[model samples]
Target chain A: MISVSMTVNGKAVSAKIDPRTLLVQFLRENLLLTGTHVGCDTSQCGACVVHVDGKAIKSCTTLAATCDGASVVTIEGLAHDGVLHPMQEAFRENHGLQCGFCTPGMIMSAIDIVNRKGHDLDEHTIREELEGNICRCTGYHNIVKSVAAGAHAMAGSK
Target chain B: MYAFAYQRPTTVRQVQSALGKHEDAKILAGGQTLLPTMKQRLASPSAVIDLGHVAGLSGIEKKGRNIVIGAMARHAEVATSEVVREAIPALAALAGGIGDPAVRNRGTIGGSVANNDPSADYPAALLALGATIVTNKRKIAADDFFQGMFTTALEEGEIITKVSFPVPAKAAYVKFPNPASRYAMVGVFVSKKGSDVKVAVTGASNEGVFRAAGLEAALKGKFNPKAVEGVAVDGSNFIADIHGSADYRANLVSVMTKRAVTKALGK
Candidate 1:
């Protein structure tokens, strides 16, 4: 076992985990942050997307030991004092989900898109940037709309 | 993933020492490929050496007439780097088109180049640009670095430190990507520097990324889209997979090369 320390959801967390433990496994099993789902253990699926040191990366493929001393943010960290983040609010309002298995990852990846591409996202830009995240339900029309709305809302909130 | 010892080395010397100590150790660059393979139990090294903590292994800078990219520099970094964009916009564009945003955030150029995946974009760029792969032991030209699919000239215990790419007067890359995986079905990279012209083809060849000498000769004679029209592509040696037949890939090689030449002309 190796000692791993990282700031997760704005809280510093430390644990001794197996060297092979993936970040997704660490989050769900050790920390119990199950909002970050694992739709596909392979990196192809974006259900394990998370923010690491301000950049978005697939947690399913990242070893927890490699993320030592890093700052990680998951879907659970988006809200504050029972108020949903603008992106979350947009998803809820715009019906960006159906079965909700991939919602956490979609929301996490959407915020990353906004952070990288800015608040004014077009249809083409949103679709292109969302290549990583997979949505089996809702046909992505509503998710695309939610991302654009969330981007604008985030800008407005700031 | 099999149980293994993990070591995060802060210096290249330390990495070398660790590799020497563990015979079956694998150097972890970005974990974009290594981690996934491990998850499926495809690779089970005795030890995994993490290069993330290495101080001088990640950066992008212009050196003399070439762009020197550190081995650990992520695809996203190369894509967004202003220096890379200004020096070689085609390279930055290629970096941007690799995988997706999330994958780019963690995938490093060194990892991709060292792995030498037949469908990877960097090999074509490196071959077309005549880049040099710098390892701790020695510097190897791109032509001599890549051996075959999933093979490189890097010796055991050797680690890639950086890659230096000479800027070309004109360059472009065009890829016919597999829709689901986004890996190139047939990718062509074309470049013209002074009197020299290079055309590198990837993803279609079973021999791995190779220079299309016929296309290069045609483009050298006349640097135009029309020059590639008469160049014949033989599919006998190409890869035939479920994604595409060898003949289909051969045709795509021709079409992508033409498009690449046109794009290089900025038309």
Candidate 2:
């Protein structure tokens, strides 16, 4: 077993995990942080999306040990003191989910995009960028709207 | 994923030693492709050496007339690097237009080139730009590097340290991506080095990335979009898959090639 240590949601966390254990498995199984979903293990689905050192990555494809001493932010970390992040609020307000299995990853990826691209996103660019995050529900119309709204909200604060 | 010993080496010498120590070891650069294969039980290495902690293997450097990119450099880094942008704008555009933001941040050039997935984008850029693959053992030209589908000239335990690409006078990449997977269904990279021109096509050929001699020859005669208008390549050498038929990919090769040339010419 490989001993791994990293900061998760601004908290230092450590675990002795198998070398083959994926970051998603470590988060869900070892750390008990299950807000990050695992839709497809093939890295095609962004259901396991999370921030590793402030950059979005597919947790299913990242090894737990590889993230040693790095910072990771997941869906569970998005809420602060009962206050939902603007992206989460927008997702909820816009009804950006159906099955909700892909919500966590979608929101994570959306927040990263907004953090990078900001509120100036167009419909086609959003569609193209969100290709990694698959949502079999809502047909992505509302998801796109939610991302736009969230970006607008964030831009206003900035 | 089978149980294996994992080690994160912090230096190149340590990486080389670890590789030499482990008999069936796999160097883990970006896990975008390898981990997925392992999850499917397709690859079960006895040891997985993580190169993430290797300090010097993750940056972009400009040396003389060449852009020396670390093998472990992520796509996003390359996409946004000032050196890459100034030296080869098309390369930055190609990197920026890879899978997605997340994949761009995680997938590394070494991982992509080492994996050599037929539909990958970096191989096309490397081949067309006449890049050299630097390994721990030796340097191999892009022409002789890619052996076959999901295969490379890298020997067992051979780790790719970096790739050096010549600064092209002008270059561009055009790809018709598979809508679902975001991998290139047929991608073309057109590059002009001095007076010589090279066109490399990926994601369409059965033997992986190969130069389009007809297009290259045409562009060599006249480095303009109009020069490649009447050139034709045998479409019999492309791979057919669920996303596109052989003929469809063949047709896309020509179209994408033309678009790439046009884009390179800024027309």
Best by TM-score: 1
* Error at A69, model 1, angstroms: 0.2
**Best-matching candidate per lDDT:** 1
Task: Please write out the lDDT profile of model 1 over residues B56-92, one tens digit for every residue.
Answer: 8988999999999999999999999999999899999
lDDT of 2 by residue, B1-267 (tens): 788889888888888889889887888998888888888889988888889888777679999999999999999999999999999999999999988789889999999999999989999999999999998889999999988788899986678999999999999999998877768999999999888899999999888988889889988998877776777767787787778888899889888988998899888
> What is the model-wide C-alpha lDDT for candidate 1?
0.94
User: What's each prediction's TM-score?
Assistant: 0.99, 0.96
Off by over 4 Å in 2: none
Lowest-lDDT window of 10 residues in candidate 2 chain A?
Answer: A149-158
Indicate the docking level reached by candidate 2: high
Residue B216 lDDT, candidate 1, scale 0-100: 92
Give DockQ for candidates 1 onward, in order.
0.91, 0.86
